[model samples]
Target: INSSIRSTYFVSKLRRISQIFYIELTPNKNLIMSVNGIYAEDSEGKFIPATQRPDGTWRKPRRVKDGYVPQEEVPLYESKGKQFAARKPQLPVGMSPEVALASRSKKSGPNVHCPIPGLVVLEDKTKKKKKKKDATVEKLANDLTQTKLDNTPPDPAKRLKNLKKKIREIESIEARLLSGELKCPEKDQLDKVARKIEILCEIKEIEKQIYWPIDTKYDFCRRL
Candidate 1:
């Protein structure tokens, strides 16, 4: 029984050692070769066979003596897109030279300009139209300016009186608002009137300080 147990233990140890050795020797499953043979990546993370020098001259299969590598011989880019191709010109047989020339030549239109220099010169195509002001709008603007001038008081006392009147009107509206008599009182209008009142009061104070009682040269001369 002791011999059997020892043999079984040796076998398990050998299996584990074998597994470790195999893992060390085997390549990683993730390191796979490219499907297409266009190019392969190396351990350095560079494409192999490596890209050719940029200074290399382009060549065609027609020549063999010039020592130029044929363009077809060079490997194509890995991510190369669709090949370029040009469309062939369509022409009708038995057509006159002048008719063919005319067909090729672009027709002169509103946008198209003549390519023949010193033969046909294109003038400025943009035509600006003059816009006339509406008489009604002009009259309204004039009336607005006249109304502003007429409403504005020239004297500080008159201006202050006007401001005070506007303030009283605003206060009455505010009182109505507080009493819920008026649903929506113009807060902005009230604020404007209040600001005007403050400004007028300041202007009146400044005028009072600026005007002082002093005997002038004219007054002295009149007394003499």
Candidate 2:
């Protein structure tokens, strides 16, 4: 009686626990800004702006210096005969091909490596030669496929065919019905043997056409 009462109490506790097993958890979606601030690396330097709360999201960029105007408006602002260009002479290649009509094939930057002093040379030809050598090495690689074929045993097609043929012959022999003179035990043995042989043949045939196109299965059975 005591054991039964104890089990009942435990089961009741389990049921209560299960009732509230999954307490719905809500994610706190209201975002608070990170304390460290976001940092982005650039060519100039690592950019980390001060967390200016007063000028936060509503801030606009300060206006450019007096001479500067929008690139399109600058042309109109200048006099017709004299176009204004930056005093700074650009790198020899100038700006992009589409913008300034500079030659697209013009070299971009100087080579860093200086094997021989005083000559700022590009190791371009040496790189090409190395690539050619790599190609030639790949081409001369021995075809190791023949070695693989030699190591592997011959195909099992002939063995499989023989086994199937033997199974068919055995099935034929077992199918002969026993006379009344033969006991029930003998007749049962013959039936068992015939069934086993049939199964073997079926397995072999299935193996042969395992990759066949389709089966003539009933649509109702297939759907279920």
Candidate 3:
């Protein structure tokens, strides 16, 4: 009987604690009413300034000055003190800086052995003479070609045949152009064809007339 009474008492206490917790968790109506009344008190909304800043506008943006070192100043180097000095090139013994520079300027030939003092370099004149003789022979051969051309007579029959062939080819080209076989005809080619046609006509006239025609001879015409 005592255990049953104790259990009932514990359950009743838990119920009372739960009731108090529910009341505390529930929102207060009075606080919500006060907040709504504060908002409605003023008809117009709270005025916001045109700009957030007190100066009315922001100051000019700062200019970038990073990596803008002066030209007079030397840039930072990885090496420091003695290590940096050691990195510089050192000249050999008995060699002055000016002498070293002069030696570098003078390029040694492929045939040169040692650049020691008092080195005798004898030039082979026999090879130079042979080369000069060969060049003279070549020049003589070129001169002989002009003489041969002047002495040689051109074959009239071969020239006439070539001229006739050119005339035929020009005619065929014109025919192809008229038939629309050639899309873009060259002006230079057309002019050449016209010139050849004129030449051919003159040659034909020369062949037809054996002798020059004589006009009436007068004393005044002979003086002019």
Candidate 4:
């Protein structure tokens, strides 16, 4: 019985040693090679050590006859995206571009912290900022319209004459900005003034038409 036990122990020891030797002799599993004559470029910009991954992890492959080895080619950034029009790459054809982009661009990693609902207040404020800018522009346009139509000192001829006069004023403002005769807009007060002037100038001609009554043109000529 003791002899049988000793023999079994010897067999187990021999098996463990043989397994370790086999492991040491085995080729690395990570090295990629072509079954057919095709091989992928190493992408590492150097002969990838015949036995290593791009990340510098070691692997094993047959060395070429010439000591020089080819590296993997790097991909071009292709400022133009996915040019082949191959259904945006993610979806088959006939899908909407929007759906294709969304699907193809889907993130494929670990779970992330979005804080989306938490950003509600921040996004709301940002939206409000844009709205405020629009409202301010609207207000500025209104003010310009008011200025042009105001013949004040409330004089009829002066009010009637504002369009040409206003054009000159707008031009003067632009000249000042261009010539540096007007201090740079980086100055706060100047920026406000510049913003007001820009909106007024942009819609000046359009705004003028709104002020003039098309139907009343006959009446005005009659008055004249």
Q: What is the TM-score (0 to 1) of candidate 4?
A: 0.17
For residues 14-106, could you state the per-residue lDDT of candidate 1 as single tens digits?
755764454345443112234342332233332323222344322221212323334555676543223322232334444455654554453
Cα lDDT of candidate 3 equals 0.53
Question: Between candidates 1 and 3, which one is better according to TM-score?
Answer: 3
Residue-level lDDT tens digits of model 4 in 1-224:
99998997786667557644544454542233433232323333212222334553445434444334345443445544556554355544455666544444544532223344222112355676898899999999999999888844554445446645655665677778889887754465455555554444434434445576555433322222
Clashes of each: 0, 0, 0, 5
Error of 1 at 41 (Å): 99
Runs in model 1 lying further than 4 Å from the true structure: 1-153, 187-190, 193-200, 203-224
CA displacement after TM-score superposition, residue 128 of candidate 3 (Å): 4.0
Number of the top TM-score candidate: 3
Q: Deviation in angstroms for 40 in model 1?
A: 99
Candidate 4 Cα deviation (angstroms), residue 31: 99
Lowest-sum lDDT 10-residue window in model 1: 57-66
Q: Residue 218 CA error for candidate 2 (Å)? A: 53
- Quantify all predictions' global Cα lDDT against the true fold: 0.50, 0.46, 0.53, 0.50
Model 3, position 100: C-alpha lDDT score: 58
lDDT of 3 by residue, 1-224 (tens): 99998997786667557644543454441111222121111122221111113432323312223343334445556657767678866766555787656555554632322354334243466866888899999999999998999999766556566767778878888888899998787997687667764657644544333233444232232232
lDDT of 2 by residue, 1-224 (tens): 99998997786666545433311121321221233333322333332322223322222223233343345444345554444445434533433434322222224643344344332345586887898899887766644566676788745565566666766655555554343443344665666565664556555555544434456332322232
RMSD of 2: 34.9
Candidate structures ordered by TM-score, highest first:
3, 1, 2, 4
